[model samples]
Target: MKNKELVENYYKDVFINGNVDKIPVYIAENYIQHNPQVEDGQAGFIKFFKNFIKTEPKIEIINVSCEGNMVYVFYKCSLPDGTINKVCDIYRVESNKIVEHWDVIESHVEKIKSVNHNSLF
Candidate 1:
């Protein structure tokens, strides 16, 4: 599968479905993570998500783009507590495996809180 497809499948199976078993298939054994909150490697990835699923966030992808070996995914997720977050993730794929990742996340502000009422999407 193409790197873009690989990333989509990974998100579908793991992030959306909460299937941790697919980690080995889509992620490299020595995966490098740029997210300071998370640890390095597949084991760390799995460990981190184990806690993440507790929130039961409904993950929704907004857009995706790919160039060379990098795939960028934009996501809007609804937290179990009713808050919303905008997340941007970048992944480096090699040999059909995700080898590195970086992400930025911020809580979405309601329109009333915005200065100009520009759309968050």
Candidate 2:
């Protein structure tokens, strides 16, 4: 499979399914994750994600765009508390293997409240 396809499948099967083992299949041995919550390499990423999805089981990929060796995915996670977080993940692939990743996460509640302006005082 192409790098983009492999990266997509990694999110679908691994992230959504909570399959930690799939990390090795899609991630390179020297993979580096730029998230503050996760250390370098696939092992750290797997650990962080496993714990993350425990309370945030509902996840959806909103969009994806790829160019050259880079792939960008926009997603959302619904927490158990009924809160939603918008997230963006960027992947850098080489030789069909994901070598680097970066992510940004922000809660949607503040944005919704600010836009609606319907909050009770």
Tens-digit per-residue lDDT, 58-96, candidate 2: 778888899889999888777777877788889999988
Please list the residue runs of candidate 1 whose C-alpha ends up more than 4 Å from where it truly belongs after superposition. Answer: 108-112
Best by TM-score: 1
Query: Candidate 1's C-alpha lDDT?
Result: 0.90
Please tell me which predicted candidate would have the highest lDDT against the true structure: 1
- Give lDDT tens digits, candidate 1, residues 1-121: 9999999999999999999888899999899999998999999999998999888989989998999999999998888677888899999999999999999888753323766757677
Report how far residue 26 has shifted in candidate 1, in Å: 0.5
Report backbone clashes per prediction: 0, 0
lDDT of 2 at 39: 81
The per-prediction CA RMSD against the true structure, in angstroms, equals: 1.5, 4.0
